[model samples]
Target chain A: MTATVSYVPAPDAAPRSRMLGAQTRMELRLLLRNGEQVGLTLVVPLLLEVFLNLPLLSSLGGSRRIDFVVPSVLALAVMSSAFTGLAIGTGFERKYGVLKRLGATALPRSVLLLGKTLAVLLLEVLQVGLVCTLGLALGWHPHGNPIWTALLIVLGTLAFGGLGLLIAGTLRAEVTLAAANLIWLVLLFAGGIAIALDSYPAPFADVARYLPSAALSDGLHHVLQNGGGLPLGAALTLLVWSAVALPAATRWFSWE
Target chain B: MPPQATHAILAPSRPDEAASGPALEISGLIKSYAGRRVVDGLTLTLARGEIVALLGPNGAGKTTTIEISEGFRRPDAGTVRVLGLDPLRDAAALKPQIGVMLQDGVGAYTGAKARELLDLFAAYAAHPHDTAELLELVGLSDVAGTQVKRLSGGQRQRLSLALALVGRPALVFLDEPTAGMDPQARRGTWGLISQLRADGVSVVLTTHLLDEAEQLADTIVVINHGRVVATGSPAELVRAGAEGQIRFRAPAGLRLTSLSDALHAGASASEEAPGRYLITGERSPQLLASVAAWCAAQGVFAEDLAVERRTLEDVFLEMTGAELSA
Candidate 1:
């Protein structure tokens, strides 16, 4: 409570997008408010990068250590914020009747989707910023075009966010809770986040490049490591994943 | 007190100005799941500014009916109109004018503070009440910054009520509006509900508290087996059966043969306690006189003479043949 708690009389004339904007703001506030969520999404990536970059403590080595670890953490950050966090939160929202109640409100389902997507995008920006600042502080110089780096992060957010929706929107909360953490662990280790695909056997590395997590990490690694102007292959892979997962999530999503 | 006295309790100042149309109208609503009819051919109407309570036993489809009317669930047959618009097809247009207090969760983000949640919901409305005033209205002004998950049960109930009224909706749906409230909180909520009606907001609530329905609802709808079993004002419902009773305390061991012969043929009287007597029969001026005559003839001073008129509880029991909480 505060002296400034005075509120405006709500107008009956606000458009759908305005309602969506308010919802997105509230969602972002809530995501940031949860200490556990912040720990998993924001802090974990920073810690992982630091540990992975240390030659004495890290299995990763030598000249490419800084380059490899920084982009990988960025990808890991997107997965944490958009994929793991989004899925668990939404699954519980569905379980707790929050989604059911919102369904009764003036905001349409499309607006709810847009609001959540917007909240994820906003958080992703914060996540990228934190990872980049930490990477720069650790003496990891960027080699990629900033514009493409930004574009890849956006596409990567959408692609992983869609899969998160697919999981949260379809599964029961308990199962979703277990499966989201499980999927995140699997992606972090085998999907080419913690370790490089180049170290894998040729057959496995080929499969890893097709994974959304790998595409994001690989694309960011190349551009940021070499100042590459465009990451067309990684960009196309992310776009295709987005195209598939988004429509599929939309088709499968259930409000309650 | 007799049920008839309830009619004049408030002396409803505004001569029931007929609303433009019923705020909510449902006819032949039928909903089934897996070939079982959960809401079967139920119909009820709620007029503007009126408080109608849905009373029933458990699994009686009270929630199902409210859900269909709110457009959260679809009915297999029949139609529902909220503010003269289809609840489902015109939901986007109709929602702003309607407030719903969900029976669980208060529909809030667990991590969001109470004040933040109220403000967030306010922004979704075309016209919403001031968040501060709304919070104060529901007595949640003190806990504005408390996270939803951190609120007490009664506090959460109040918060849910505030969320519903924040939009100043023309019509509202409250499912068990005072289920977890303490006695004081319950009365406070009742006062707020009366105020909502005074402001011309229609209310439809489901409740297990018989006194709650009697005290608040202008009309009560009782459902059983997924169908409307009874619909009437409290007074009217009480009078439906028209069986009144007389109770008195007196010396035990009074011979019943004379008393039985002196009364109407069908009347039955029984001593339920050592010195207590109950007489069940048609309650009329003549029956009271006859009972008085019997007491005088027996030369017994019948202390604590009491007349028990049929009440809404009796009507509900007779209709559903089950407890309200069953």
Candidate 2:
């Protein structure tokens, strides 16, 4: 066959920002479309927020049950989306060769990780908006600086998101699925989200407060429920988790 | 076949870089897995716009060699240069120029819609082919909205092919490109691959289908036991050291002594079965004429007379000592 056009021999990568944006959007779209993820990230948090506020359950002494329930549920939202949802989703993506395919593209590995983090962050924003709206409709009143709440949310996400990816990248899909759910359940009941940390015996509460989930929940509860200043102790715990987990994930994460 | 000559003829209008060197160059490539050498000191070069097929039996290191070239696996020893740049050291610069389709559905997002998946890959390139046009080219336009996991094996293979082209890559590495495809889809893919060559794209593909190698590759490399046993054009490999035979059906048990004398000294005749005769010799017009002339002299007509040249499959089996599919 005769050549119709000269070979240009020019193959340039797209701008980094464009690649990150496209990957983030694709990741978020898949996260939202998955029925189980949506239920876990959004619907379940909203349901728990309402369910725990009912008078049928024995209420802890509080100014208003809505205030306490709202903060705890917000913390729960962060954990479910950033840890459980992200873990299950990424585990299956690895199992199905999705990450292997992406490895061949021009998109950098850092960009892929950042894109998934950004997608998780975006989903958290939606979750926060919905949970806050319902809290307001239920006459919940929150105090403390909004910036503290934002900081806790962001750092909590990175900490949990990093750990989630570590599990997904290193373990089999079915194992990750089971472990993530089991961890979520264990943390929900014992990690100061569904129950106040003080309610636990002194020895148990001491260790429970160090858990990432408990740190997030307690930090949010101190700021949003008690109108307190920055909870430095809880913030430090989350910061340490993020510092350790992110690098471990970056070092050990396998594409296949 | 003088691949450089073929490259010059097919892509005469290409720029200086296209003429400067081969599209891919590998020297003394060696890779091992778990104490076993999967690819042992293999060397190959591919010219611009040439389609080279890596033909081998199972565990012959075709996939390992391709993976090293694609930069997915590191070589234990040797050098690999794709588009005149190191695949690992210069990967950021090289990845955009080379597309890859891995084996066993390793290159697609299972949860993504076909269109979305293509669009996502396209976003990684500065200038990409239109998604609709690419899908149409691969005959996957009808299933663009379907999730990748929901598509049939053939549809997924075509979608993978479409992904490899969306970036307008200069070279593409396709592993088993048509393994799960139907005959019609496979034909469409072959046409698309040929079009890629026409448009000045280099292709390196690994396949068990010897017919695919013979039908599409400009040069065929037959490898066995992690080493290249033979490398040549399809016609050249078939013609290399493989004798031609002429077979015919005639009345059995006829005296063949005179018939053998009528033909050349090197030729021999045999009747191993009832009413069947076989002639082993160099195939030529003179030999054919002698056979016809001898039959007439003996007042016997030869039925089902035909000349048979060695096929690529036969050559491959002889080289590999294993079936292609095994």
Candidate 3:
């Protein structure tokens, strides 16, 4: 028997804002409440600042350690919230079939990813603000344009979050979880610190400038420490990373 | 009054049939995992408000098949239409009208309260059920404030069910929804399912428990080795059994020669155990009575005398050549 078909398009359907906004808000709440997320985004940066301020490191830096540490730490905060958070969370969600459940919903996949990105951006803004407040309390002041700094943060998060999803979506959950967290730690220490990338020497320092953490840190520092305008070169590098990583991540993401 | 009744009375029913087409239809569904076909050449149709149970053994392709239907995975080869839209082609459009509950939903949200998670999901649709009403519907109001991590297994499953229903979906897919529930919890879920059906919501579920399928399914489709072996009403399938089983004990020294000759006329017997024998293929009442009369005449006493209707378990084992996991 032939099945009859008819089409009725809903032209007056409400805009997709409600669902997108709610998904982002819920993601933010879940991230904040998670202990590891809290530690990674909040406590880790604050502790890193304190550790960088040690007197033994004072000889290695002419500038106040807090001045140098704050910007790099902000980048760290963004990475944690964007890259590590997305990777670990998405990996677990995939492992536990959360994404598969969502896949079956009527919510668009693009909207889902967009909501998550927005949530991560919201988290980075809050983290940057909080860390900046603490830096001001410590008498550390940024000399660069705030607008340029904000742009870097947003673009940097997109790039990192895209890479995070790419890793989490393609690899086994355990492997993704382990590799993401480990990369976070390695980048934290080995990549350019409050110390200059050039000061480290040889292959390590040369490769450091290419690392995303290093790119973001270098960009933020040029703007924040030197009172400079947005660094177009660094922005372009991160943009290229974002352009490639975003598509790769979305293409590879698995619901299960 | 029950929660479902309140909603049913308040809501106006949609037209019985959509002007568009079948609520869901799939043809030539096929999927494989690591080169092994899990769901091969499966076709299914579900109308609005129909609850169909996809019954099968472990790894029998039920989950794979449903995942494809739900648009979680792309089919290797198939045409799937959900609510007149292809799930793969129009996933975004179809998702709002359907809900999915997977078998495992552990450790996703860390400290989010149950109600918070529900509200979060509910927000994903233009029309969302009231958070309180949804919680109440799933019997989760008392634990609204509880973090998901702290919820018991049954409570978590209930929360998952609530998540699936919160969108007020026209179609829902539940994978082994009652795996860890106690009897009370299982019945509660069944009650919820019945309520969903009454409200004109269609559900497709995969489960190994025959009783669940028998209780909740309007139609049951059984799959074995990635192929649909049988599909029918529980009663019709049971009625097709070739024969019934009869059990009796022979009198000491009565000897198998006489019993075999007596039952060979219309039945067959085998020593299923040392002292007990099972006579199968006994179609005539006279043969059953003759066996009983022979036992009596031989002064043999038989215990555990009981006859049972054929069950889904019997049909499943017979057709699939495999046992359903408890």
Q: Highest DockQ, which number?
A: 2
- Comparison by lDDT, 2 against 3, better one: 2
List of chain B TM-scores, one per candidate: 0.86, 0.87, 0.87
Note the Cα lDDT for every prediction shown. 0.83, 0.87, 0.77
Residue-wise C-alpha lDDT for candidate 2, range B1-326, written one tens digit per residue:
22233333333223565457798898999998999999998998899889999999879999999988888889999999987878889887778888889888735668789999999999998767668877877778889999998999888888988788777788999999998999998887887788888767899999999889988999998988788889999999999987778889888887788888998979888886988988878888888999999999889989999899878887888887788772
lDDT of 1 by residue, B1-326 (tens): 12233223323212242237787899999999999998999999998779999999888899999989998898999989987878889777777767889887487677889999888888887556678777887788899989999999999999998888776577789999998889988998888787777656789999878899999999999999899998999888887767889998899977777776777977878888888888888887777788889999878999999999877778788888998762
Docking quality (DockQ) of candidate 3: 0.27
The value of fnat for model 2 is 0.53
- Per-residue lDDT, model 1, residue B149, is 92
lDDT of 1 by residue, A199-245 (tens): 77899989888999999988887788767777889999999999999
* Per-residue lDDT over A1-256 for candidate 3, one digit per residue giving the tens place of the 0 to 100 score: 0011101111111257987887888888888888888998888888877677667664435467777878888889988989998898888878876676666655567877888999898888888888888888877977978999999998899889989999999999999889998998887767665566777768788767877888888899889988889998779878988999999987877666
Q: Tens-digit lDDT track for model 3 on B1-326?
A: 23343343322223333433666788888888899998889888877677889899999999888877777678888788877777777766667777778776532464679988887777775556667876776678899999988998888888888788776677788999987888888998898787777767778999999999999988889988888889887777777764677775543344666777777465676676676777776466776776787678777887665444567788899999999989
Leading candidate by lDDT = 2
Candidate 1, lDDT over the whole model: 0.83
Q: What's candidate 2's DockQ score? A: 0.47
Error of 2 at B229 (Å): 1.6
- Residue B150's lDDT within candidate 1 is 93
Clashing pairs in 2: none
Off by over 4 Å in 3: A1-15, A59-65, A202-207, B1-22, B106-110, B242-244, B252-304
